[model samples]
Target chain A: MFNKDNQLEKFKDAETIIGASIKVKGNFQGQGSIIIEGSLEGSLKTDANLFIGDRAKVTANIESKDAIVNGEVRGNIKSKNYLAIGGTAKIFGDIQYGEISVAKGAIINGQLMMLSEEHKRNDKLKPEEKAVATDK
Target chain B: MHVYIYDDYLNKSKYNKTINRIEIRLTDLGLNGKIIRLGGIKNIKGTIQNEIKLGAKTIVAVGNNQTINKIIGAVIDTDIYSDFQKKTILGIIPVGGDNSIAASFGIKNEEEACNILLARRVEKIDLGIVGQYYFLNQATIQSLGTILEIDDYSLEIIKRGEVSIINLLSDKNQSIKSNPHDGKLDIYIKTKRKDQTYLSAKKLLITNPNNKLLVDGVIEMATPIEVGISKDRVNVIVGKDRMFE
Candidate 1:
């Protein structure tokens, strides 16, 4: 079993928290980390990592350095470093990531593309660490 | 010079004991200055402005939130707001009920409040401005049929919700804190579907037909209101337990 706490502990430092009762509609651009537990309808771009809670319903194109999603998303997602789709996630958009993890029971209905980088950077990623999906 | 403005309500005999104690403490610390009684004054704003012009460096509110609210309302409206932004400071000595504003400053009781004043640790804090009113806390606007126009985008709430633009929270909730030092204001929306939305904006425009923006749970004004930060931040004496650094 994945240690959910270990996966989410880092986001506790997240400066922006969208609580479960809020529904926002706007292009959100921020430098600080963000955690979404509510609904977003526009676009999201951030320099730091992003976390989507299990019950979050997002309809925004998301761009982040790192992302972990365990909710329902309906737009495209691009992560420069890493992307993790949890078991309960339901995604219906294209994805771009340097490294990716999709746990069992997660649903995706879009194409996935690996971000292009130098060969030395790609070589640093072990064979066991690239596209580590439980079942795709 | 420090000027202590005591709220009119504090004039009631019920509060005589606390008032006497506070006066003694202020005198003991050699921090006492001119005292203004609000009950006898007709034009509070003028009184505050007059004190400012006469070289009162520190303005202290000696009652609850309502007391500080009135004093702040007066202070921000004066011309001195722009000229001496840092030279003048606001202090709070929470005397009676509804003093969450003081607690947020890390001040607990009147005794500690005096000590905090003596220490004179100051911080620049933001305030939410709407027309003639300035709020230290948050502004609540009814979500129904409200359109919030931010810089690059607009937001509309289809579902029932409460929209608040927060400079700082009134209560001390460790769960989440809205930083008063941040130049941006936090936009919070709570909907009926158990959905919550949180974002921050530097400035925004609120358009609501026949609705008003309730500022700091005090003043009410009609909408198409432009809400933004005060052009100049106010210096406030704060304690270590202040909600924001």
Candidate 2:
């Protein structure tokens, strides 16, 4: 049982948390983890992990280091590392990830693209990014 | 040298005992200095500027949040007179209501405030600025249908929430500890559902006209005002019990 609020304790050091009451509609770019529980449109790009809560309704193309989705999304998601799709997740766009875990009841309405290991993105990454991706 | 600027409200007799005790403690600690009552002053910023010119090293505000906020605005405003030898240090003694700023600095009461001042643990802190006023803690506004523009992005708060711009975090329950030494401001947005967000930026603009910016929980100014931190820093006297280092 992934209790939404309780799970937040794990990311207590999160750099940003877009609460359920907020509706963002532009390019939100940053350098740390971001948790979204609200309604968002446009694009989200982060150099770290992203956590989408169960109540969230997002319509943005997302890019992150790692990702966990539990709500509804209508845009493409790109996770450089592992992508964990929870049972209650409802996504409507293509996905790109290195490795992924899909739970029962997860409804995805688009193609799933597994990044090729030959790309060797990890080896090409800057030292700082490799460290962050490993830590996650 | 220490120069205490007493707020006008403290003139009431109810605070006599606290004031007397504070004076005795300050004298005993060899920290007693000139006391100027705000009741007799008209232009606060000018008076403070004159004190800095006269080599007043420490300026202590004796009152609640309003007192501290005024002093911060005044003290920080005096930074242009930097030809002086030392940066004037700002201190506070919480004597009345709305003393959150002082409490964040670990100055709970007038007596404890005196001892904290004696410790003289000075910190260089950032100031949140809106219009001509400055705040040492945080600035807040209602997030009901508010639109904010930061850099190239814009945020529209749909549901009722709170938008806070933090320089120095006073809420111990908050997950992120705000470092006042950092030049950026921490923007915390929380909805009624307890979901929250934290963003750090140098400056942001409120695109909505219906919003009012509440600085340090004391002063309220009209909306659509640009909010950011002052380029200059202030030296503050804090205590060990302070919420943030």
Candidate 3:
């Protein structure tokens, strides 16, 4: 959905969707945003956003640029950018995020760590640092 | 060094002027090649084989999407094409119907196609393969009770709609980075609901007998088919503003 300033973020156009009836059990890594509405038992990693639908059940550690969770997650979540925990979300793992927004009814059973500004900046510069180190 | 394969439909009386204009443009651009009018769709592979044997380095398909797929199929079948892989390049001069493939390559018309051929800017692109057939664009299956298996993921559809395995993003305005050179196919399964979604992977296996598999808008095969990417498969001449990038 394109609005003024083009800042609208919707997972409607997600490149990958894990439907409600399917179950995945492997290390899932890819380039594009992924939507999960089913069951997953793997380490999920992506440089794009991750959307967990309300009916979804995920049992994996999620590493993503951004994430919006409304389902059940049994592992740690590391959002490099923004993480939104919806009202229906039942998260049972430690959370680490650059920026976080949690709804009233969301349940988090583990510690929540707001990433420090210095850490965020360092995370942003890791690629450039690696490039520089490689040049040496 | 170019061999032009014109579709048989161009031989109709109404297309004489259009063909003449194309030929004149080709001559004016100093990019004239051996022109072969296809007698029928069945003879396309054999005609291409004859032209390849005649030492044609570039095979320019002058027709719509179906004609392009036929030429592509001939080129990829090593048993028939006989080792013309890296040596031969494909070009398109869109003549009729929905020529999305030509538009994707940034060739608008006959003159632009000739210009691209003259420029000789060849890009090695990936192609979607279903059995022995090679498709330049996406392939689709429209039916209910279908299951799509890609890599380690499997999606079962109970409602009827369409499942598209996209190789190159046809819509220019589409923001997704679905590239033909990326060696990955974008699988989009659109059902009736607005909420149901799917993902992408390599080596797709669609299991169902109730649907027809359409490659580039033409019904080529049935369901229960396997789709995979053939990487760096074809060298194709593309316009300066080619869409695949």
lDDT of 3 at B35: 82
Candidate 1 colliding pairs: A20-B195, A20-B196, A21-B195, A21-B196, A22-B195, A22-B196, A22-B197, A23-B197
Best by TM-score: 2
iRMS of candidate 1, one decimal?
Answer: 3.6
Q: Would you list the C-alpha lDDT of every candidate in the order shown?
A: 0.82, 0.82, 0.79
Weakest lDDT window of 10 consecutive positions for candidate 1 chain B: B168-177
**In what order do the candidates fall by TM-score, top score first?**
2, 1, 3
TM-scores, all models, native as reference? 0.83, 0.88, 0.77
- Tens digits of per-residue lDDT, candidate 3, B27-86, equal 998888798888655766777877777778988898888778778777575664545675
- Residue B85 Cα positional deviation in candidate 3, in Å, after optimal superposition: 2.6
Residue A72 displacement (Å), model 2: 2.2
DockQ (C-alpha based) per candidate is: 0.31, 0.63, 0.31
* Interface RMSD values, listed in order for every candidate: 3.6, 1.3, 3.6
Candidate 2, which segments miss by more than 4 Å at Cα? A1-10, A118-124, A127-136, B78-85, B171-176
Per-residue C-alpha lDDT of model 1 across residues B1-245, encoded as one tens digit per residue: 99999999988999999989988999999999999999999999889888887888899999988887887777675676654475678999998778878887899999999999999999888888887677888899888777888876676666566888988776664245688887878887777644656678878999889578888777888989899986337788899988775
Between candidates 2 and 3, which one is better according to TM-score? 2
Q: How well is candidate 2 docked (DockQ)?
A: 0.63
Candidate 1 off by > 4 Å: A1-5, A19-23, A118-136, B142-147, B155-162, B190-196, B207-212
